[model samples]
Target chain A: MGESILSGTVFAAGISVGPAILPGIFPLAPLLAFNPFTEPVGVIHYMIVGAVMFTAGVVCMALKRNALGVLMGIELVLNGANINFIAFSSPYLRGDGAPTLGLDGQLIALFVILLAAAEAAVALAITLNFYNNHATVDIDRADDLKG
Target chain B: MTGTIRMDSIFTSVLLHLPAPTAPVVAAVDWHSVLFLLFAGLACGFAIAVVAAENVVRMALYLVFSLAATAGLFFLAGADFLGAMQLMIYVGGTLVLLVFGVMLTAQAPLVSIKPSASDRALAGIAGAALLAVLLAAAVSVDAWRKPGVGEIPSPTATPLGMALVGVRVDDPPAGAPLTGRSGYMLPFEIVSVHLLVVLVGAAYLARAKRRKTPRAIDVLASSDPPSQGAVLAAAVPAVRTTSGAGGKSALLGGGH
Candidate 1:
């Protein structure tokens, strides 16, 4: 029972930390004395991770009938992009003097965020229009152009 | 002996006590990175689930979790101010707005809205492809992969604040210290204006929706006169049938 709950939370839900997994996979106690303040090894592995959020967001936007679902997709897409931008700007993660984006990446990310907000507003406006006219938000029904 | 030592503090000692082969894995694992990894995975996973789940309320919940995790990612990546901004603006402010919208629009029992299975399959494939392309592009470069990023001193929030006005604060390398780092003051101002507009717009959209009757409770109250104590009597199911039998529209007309 313990194993079932533990495994469910860890792998299925993606809640368990790597250290916990390591301790389970191998056999060792965590370094409680290893002060997190002192980061000897920097942020290489952080960038390599392909965010699953981005893909999920895409699927939602494409498949869902609700306007909110589409909006969530946009947020997810932005989040995925954000992971990259942050990884690039993070001095702790990048090589020393490796022509990293530094603050530029963050600046670009900020623009993307602003643009995304604008897009959401415009999309919501359009959605409200559709709702007023048709009384439903199902995009599939928006086939007046088909005839 | 175990009582004398806290289990976590004795990393080396704990390793000795545990079985072999894990020594290498334990030695390699960095706890600092572990925190970020867990949070990031959560933000990503819940986001996907939000897309999959049909319930709007549940979607909002997932979105809340995802945004919170992103804030954690920001702090972990050394964007402390940005992280705080994310929490304040994205989570606290924007999410509340989203919930309000959900509640308002949730008419007719407000339940799950399922899409076609074929649509789901197609989107899943498309999303998977996009992810593959993006992931491939992100990790393909050599500079990001093994950056060997040296010790970067955590900069003060003061400098970041200063640079928002168009000052390049992160130490520039060259003749005449490049003065072009634009402070974020302009964008911040713009975002403030944008949010104000959004608030006015959302309020305008939701104001005083016309309904046939005020409410179930109001309809009952209006049927009985206060002088005759009919208001109190109106609560009885027997009185409701007679008063309400006149048709709900008639009761509302009698209110005036």
Candidate 2:
């Protein structure tokens, strides 16, 4: 049994060593410690990621001429906020005495996801109607309502 | 006593002589962090890709990847039930949106709508500033910087289920009054009703409409034949001016 365990250990080590060495081959070795692989991640890391996605979504909404593209942006923005809620509520991501949100965060995220789906449905229907009327899906031409 | 001491020393020596265990090396990988990195990278990358891509179909596809990655993030954060819900609803929503995009853009002219270069530059600058502010705020929270508990929380599906029905089965908020906290029953009911209304409204809005032009067959079927001819002559000019590429009369060529 001991012999089998030792052999398995050696085999696993051999496999892991190859990948670990390959990452070293990259020029970013000096920044290896800062990599998420080397350290335990926390809520802040998740928050930063959420921020990036939210910003991307905002930019998408602002720049995309296609109505569907704008809808996609809105989805991204909602997901970003959902990430933050989950991260904040996550017990695993909370340190001792951190006053975590417990189930509330997840609850809010759940509602957000549901509402987002509903919003998307209504928005898509509107976009289709707009396309039917105007013969285009570009938001730029949606100025029929403009005063 | 001497014999036991000698046995202990021998056991220690045996452990020391054997190859150091590989447990540390294995544990060092931090699979949680690795998965977090993988999911977060994909989510953010695909979101940006969705924004950058001009083709609506490609943007929808990228949005799928981004939302799927987000679902993975939810799972990592220990919201397994929410994660699954996100996957099911969000992906279904995306699929519906994709169908709409395909249907509307089947007329090849509408496939890609490129925004002006000035618009792109302005949006980029605004996005950057917003990102800077958000990142600064996210990092500035001192309590949030503390390392997490790093333990799998007990599954929360049951408590969440109860909570939705107006029961606060989970732990109450810290330092709150002894009076029991309220649940989400009100909002739940409201959303359910709202969704129903949205469904009906959307169906009404998207239903196929009769073409504006009076078809020749329809005119022949009408009792007032001479007056129909006069009506067609009067309508033709208006239809010609309004219907641009796919003129209304031509669209009715194949009876719906």
Best by DockQ: 2
Q: B1-256, model 1: which lDDT tens digit per residue?
A: 3345565446655666653333432233344456766776778778877888998778888988988988887777777766776787667755665665566455553346788888888888887788767656654555544434444536536556666666666754222225554567788678778867875775555333444544456555443233222333333333333444335424332432
Q: How far is candidate 1 from the true structure (C-alpha RMSD, Å)?
A: 14.2
Who wins the lDDT comparison? 2
* lDDT (Cα, tens digit) per residue for candidate 1, span A15-78: 3354555553331212221223233333434443325776777787787777766777777777
> Could you say which candidate leads in TM-score?
2
lDDT tens readout by residue for model 2, B89-140: 8886655665566666656767788999999999999999999899878766
How does residue B206 of candidate 1 score in lDDT? 34
Those runs of model 2 whose alpha carbons end farther than 4 Å from true positions after fitting are A1-35, A145-147, B1-26, B173-180, B209-256
TM-score of chain A of 1: 0.65
C-alpha TM-scores of all predictions: 0.64, 0.73
lDDT comparing candidate 2 with the true structure: 0.74
